[model samples]
Target: MLKKLGQFTLSILVVSLYSNITSFANNKPLTEAEFKATKLPYSVMAYSNKYAHEYGLDASKAIKLPKGLEAIKLTLSKSFSKGYGPYASKWDYNCTAELYVDKSLNLYWPGDHAKVDKVDDRGLQKSQISTAQLEKKGKYWVPGPYASMLYDAYDKTVKADLASVKLSFFGCGYIPSRYTAAKDGLAIWLEKKGGYNYAVIGQGEREISSKDFYVFKLPQNLVNSYLPYARMAAN
Candidate 1:
């Protein structure tokens, strides 16, 4: 009789402990409200380094980046490479160029050429950024050749208090050549200050095949709030 009673007591204690643990887990949130308050700036590194880092390699190469901007590189899918250019190589996979204005910016991996999605409140919209408008410079395409197209589109499309903006270039797939080709790249513009705090120019969709110009805008207050945390992470 005593043995049975002790067993019942132990079972009751186990059930009580489990209930408390479950309650604690259910109440906890993924991230604290303070952490969500701000956005961080992202870093820029060479394509080779970023690729090597992803595969657990010791990447030591450093690529010079423009002022107030960081570099981003992406690799193309095997199937995409095989279909686009017969001479495509493993190195050719690292064709896309990425630049981040904020060093603490979050890292995102949206296969090949993904499209940007629409968001609310922060004043983000899709602009008509076509490859046809970009200028061909030697082997690569440059936005400097077609600044007017972007400015005109901004004036016609963006309805907000404009303050400051920056533009960068991105390549989608590998093209067979001594250097990156003009047609293989696209232009991206980001708005640093204005009605919105964070804005980016890239593809409108997040799919691997989509490649076009897109503008993303966010609130300045939201980004500023997270600056401290972002700085810590960068260091």
Candidate 2:
């Protein structure tokens, strides 16, 4: 009986250790003092201080987004830049701050060179697509699950169309790839049927094909059908 009790206690300890490791992997909070001790990007620290005072080092809680970014639902993670490069950044760019928008996106803001100029060499001073543009199109921000579903469909496609056509499939798959501020969702494909190149929208029961792709638009209700998939993908 005593050996069984010891085994049970050991099992509990293992479970507790696993939980703590998982929490850390998910960006659990650090103590305020521990957070302040690290070298952080000026813009991230300043912005957090200004707008999200309650979220200092505690990323598990939701951080309130500013007005321009309110249209989309995104979880923001506050962390210093890993570095600058094609796949990842170099250590010299460590002064840069990054906002991890869940697992799908990373929004970066320029750091104040005057503040951390000594270590801040390349802080991505010029972005091709600025945050202002993102804000302007925030209504189209695909929720996590939807994004994952789209990615999965594209990843696991048994057949694909021309690159210029903007579509892929697995025997008539209905994965939604894009949504618009106009309250429309779209997935497009191109195929030669009856010796005519036809552009197709949607698949299976709710399918449409036409020469002019612009004419094919999904209604709000149909577009909303993917929300469950999107929600599921996010979790």
Candidate 3:
């Protein structure tokens, strides 16, 4: 899988640096046989070693961040949320991204038909955000290429009955002051199958044991430094 990904990225590099290549999605999905015949375009966000050490998340350096980016906001599936379900990855879906802040639903437009919760004015008047989360409507975003690619791949390759997801993030980190250690990831309810399976690759990667969210104890300084690479890659 890594070899294939490398080839795809090289193809993408050629297109990005030289000419315009169109349409990653094709009538017939990519096949190994066809791919072997010719390299195709694919770009991935690469993170730096210095940046990886800064985050203190030595999971997979292969998950590259866009270049020169500080940090990118992202919306993830429930599979990775705290209190995860049967099909979620205990690893990627971690406490670092959960909406854990205690927030009271104060109000919502559209009568909250989707069960959208609004924070009570009294709740969390203002705080500092250290982690990333998903954005609802009226939210602007500038994610890196991989986020879109992952979403597309999930929609195409994964057979599980995943729900319609419309999430966006900003390439430059935002100034929102809400806690996300509880609300994001799969634990908050998204997939009907109630589980998440990685699309491909990442075999034998190490994962922390599922305990309380935030078990990794990511410090603010580390996050701040590493976030840039994540932003650039995901932007």
How do the predictions measure up, each by TM-score? 0.23, 0.17, 0.18
Cα RMSD, each candidate? 22.8, 21.1, 20.1
Residue 146 in candidate 3, Cα distance off native in Å:
25
Selected candidate, larger TM-score, 1 vs 2: 1
Query: TM-score order of candidates, best first?
Result: 1, 3, 2
Q: Model 1: per-residue lDDT, tens digit, 118-170? A: 21222343222223334555654433222211111111111121111222212
Q: Put down candidate 3 lDDT per residue, 90-177, tens digits, no spaces.
A: 4231112211111121211122233222322211101113223433233332111111111111111111211111122222233221
Off by over 4 Å in 2: 1-182, 187-192, 195-216
Off by over 4 Å in 3: 1-98, 103-111, 114-168, 173-222
Better of 1 and 3 by lDDT: 1
Better of 2 and 3 by TM-score: 3
